[model samples]
Target: MANLESFIRSAEHGSFSEAGRRMSLTPAAVSRNVAMLERNLGVRLFHRSTRRLTLTEAGEAFRVGIAEKLDGIQAAIAEVATGGGEPAGTLKVSLPPSLGLTYILPLLPGLLARHPGIRPEWHFESRPVDLVAEGYDAAIGGGFELSPGVVARALAPAHIIAVASPGYMAGRVRPADPAGLRSLEGVVMRAPRTGRIRRWTMRDAAGQEMPVLLPESVVVNDPVAMREAALLGLGAAMLAVPDALPALESGQLIRLVPRWYADAGAISLYYASRTLVPRKTRVFVDWVTDAFGKQKLAERFAGSLM
Candidate 1:
């Protein structure tokens, strides 16, 4: 029964050979074990051919049942291992670079204190990821672009704000309003969406929408670097409120204009599925949610301007 279960899971992973490697068994052994189980059950679980191996109706049904059973077993084991105390496991999470450094990294100590046995390994990326295919337990990004069957938790609304260093604006002409942005030299992100230059989209006081395409001098995609440039008097650029807060409070970076608001929408944390959520993913989510509830994070970071 154990071999049969292993074979079924391996098959579901898309390749017999790959499954064998994962289960630490030989491909021939896995094939023979599955074949014996099919013979004993008197049903075809897999339709085998040289070109492809496909699941039979019985096999599909069996897989669905086994997948659920496997998930239950994992959860039971996690519960027992933790002894209803602290969660214990290696948690794998992927996060956007700026958010990970600004938020999660700072809160690591608290999370570790709560679940001393659990260790979280985070991937700070500027690109999207496939949770199941990449073997990630969870992912945090500015937006939820994941396919259906994935679960999402809203972390916070990521507000993009336009700011510039005090030194940069000291002697130069600052944009008096949204219309004056045309004359200001701006530093924007260099990416596929940004092309040759970037535009800072803002809303006026009268609820009017505008896209301000200012003059470009510096273009870089790294958010942290952009924040540094803005602090060092590079030029006016749009940044996430959280990333800009420290500089704003320290008077390193100041709001570009009171009328223009750069809004990039919300940020969220997503996982492949709740049905098979690992203990590590659950504990991390719980910790972040608790942190969000207690902190005036946005306001504290944005300073008095926001």
Candidate 2:
């Protein structure tokens, strides 16, 4: 199984040396493992010339059939083994910058404790990432914005709420209706990945989704920064419930529209096309989904005032 996975990763990487580094094996060891597999199969998988390791016709066909499936099986085995033994291996994941810091980072330690052998390598970026080309095992972010050929699993849904600090609301009259969103100063977010302003969406009385327009006063890309600004009374900002939960509880922030909120949609994890998900990734995904699913963000703080 090691030989098969190593060989397949080497092919995807286009160089045994590169694949060796990713797998943490010596180049010589990688070559030997491939050779053992070739001997067992009685076929030349790679036409290994001095210049480059080229996949033979048979190798190409074999990879097409087994690569992703082999990866998934390997992941499952590792995850299942964690209960009795340490799940030792590197797992790579990609996520949005703000979500990675605020949500995933906090949950990571527990995951590592449960599987002491698993080492997590996280890539947090605002730009759209190519999971397969970048070799990420999985990713977490808003909705199902996965690239073609990827698979996604929804973990939890979050609603967007407009919030400000108590000081900001102390001198101001709160709007009694959703249309009142237009009168307040808005904090605009420039999405680091898409380079677009974070849009606020809400359901009208008729239950039709509509975009809320507010007076833009501050624009930023990072979510944490935006949250901080909102706490300091810069302006009202729309944020995911999970991101705003702590501040709301601490009395550092106050909800603007208590009953009306934007529909932020679900958060999910996306992975490259594989027949079986890697064991570590599956385990983490399961844990995260199970952990966050119990909370209903929209209903929890509907009338919260900090």
Candidate 3:
């Protein structure tokens, strides 16, 4: 069972080193366990190399067959061991770097103070992750395509607003509409997966929508870089609210069209939809929702553009 767990984690991360880090073992130990598993199965599970490690055909099929069952077995054992009391175990989660740091990281200290038994294994991801396939216990972000047995609970509106440094907006006239935004240079973002400049449809409070066609003067794949470029007076940037909110509040970045914003959907907390959710996850979900409501973050995030 330990060998199989090591193999599944190694496969999920594609690196023994990372798997070892997660499992609190050395890379060599993880490698040895995987070797033992392969020997026991009488098949090569991985094609090893100095630069990369890949699962063989038999390994992939084996992982597909046993991964879910292994997880269920682990969960059942954990429930019995803890007696379903104070939830204890490492809770693996995926979160976007910039946004997660801004909004979620600060909430961690409180969560730990309340639930010392729960250990957090948080990974910063710029894109949506496959919760089950990647072995994440939870994921927080927007625009994730729902997979089987996953559910999303929206935390707040993820609004994208055009922003520019005061120096960059100094000499230019404020755009009256999205079309007028073309007069300014834009440090646009390339879609991480598509490798194309992202398009935006700006909407006003009146339910009017307009397509924004900015001349892409500079391109970046990272949201943090996009915000920095705009901060350096390079060009206008369309940034998610959580990414831009700090700067906007500090007068580092100002809204372009205060009345217009893009709706990229809501920043949501996603977890397994199973009825018998782990207590750690249940507590986390409840804590986050309760805190978000008390702080009125949804209203703050939504009313910022207005």
Candidate 4:
């Protein structure tokens, strides 16, 4: 196990010294562990040099075969050690910044209190992440294309609505229909992957969907920033209902057309597939699902309002 771990870490870091630092061992110890593993396997794993370390072809194959299995083994051991106790490990996750801060962050304290052994390492980004390739335990967001060996559990619907500050709407006539929004100044978001300004298509109370063109006055790349622009009375902006809920509740912002919203698909928690799922990930998935259920957030996230 130590030899496998040493080899994996060394390959990842590209240096035995760095791997040793990570594993809390001396560089010589890491090298010796790898050397022993190589002798037992009867193959050179890495081509070592004073300047750099490169993986041999056989090393690449071995690492690919063992990396996922090693993670499973580690998770299994942690699970057994904590049988009937709390799950423990560094839980690495990726989340969308605004949604994570507004909705998910508040739930963490409770989760952590329940599983005190768990440590969370969270990355906040809007882009979809490759969970396995990036070594992430899980990710929470929408629009993720699930590759093979990955699965998702839906948490809530990502419904988008058009909103603007009361101040911005005061002098202008309120939009009675989607066409009315055409004349309004728009604060829009640019697609991160495509770099094109996103167009808004909304569904009315009758379930009719149509695209509305707004005269763009301010353009940004982030949903959070688009909300900020709307709050500043820059223009009418399209934002996720959850992202805009706080401001809407506080009366700082108002919906342009009450019964209309855009469907951006469901927000989901994504994780890797394995027979013996990691207890840490399982607990988190259940906790989040329960939290959303208890709060009745699914209805809210679905854009249902009084």
Cα lDDT of model 4 by residue, 1-306, tens digit: 678778987998899998787556799999999999999999999999997679999999998887757667655655675684778767889999998998888999999999887879899998999998887889999888899778999988888888899999987999887778888999998998998989878887687887878887899999889999999999999889888988999999999888888888999999987766778888988988899899988887776452
Candidate 1 C-alpha lDDT tens digits along 1-306: 445644555566756676566445687877887888888888888887765578889888877777746545555555655666667665778988777887888889988887787767789987778776666778887655767557778767666777888878888887776667667667778765445454567775577777777666788877787888787787888888888876777888888776667666667778766454556678788888778768966444432236
Provide TM-scores for the models.
0.72, 0.74, 0.80, 0.86
| Candidate 2: tens digits of C-alpha lDDT, residues 1-306 | 668766876787778897787667788888998999999998899988667888999899888877656546555544454543544667888887776787677888989888776778988875556677677778887655567668877665556787888898887889765568777787779876578887777664456555678677999887777888888888888887777888888889887767666766666678765554566666777767665655542245332321
lDDT of each: 0.71, 0.73, 0.86, 0.86
Determine which window of 10 residues in candidate 4 has minimal summed lDDT. Answer: 73-82
Clashes of 1: 1
Residue 61 in model 3: shift from native, Å? 11
| Overall local distance difference test of candidate 1 | 0.71
Q: Where does candidate 2 have its weakest 10-residue lDDT segment?
A: 297-306
**How far is 261's C-alpha from truth in model 2 (Å)?**
0.3
Model 4, residue 99: displacement in angstroms?
0.6
Clashes of each: 1, 6, 0, 0
Candidate 2 residue spans exceeding 4 A from truth = 14-18, 38-88, 127-133, 146-151, 191-196, 204-211, 271-275, 293-306
* Worst ten in a row by lDDT for model 1: 296-305
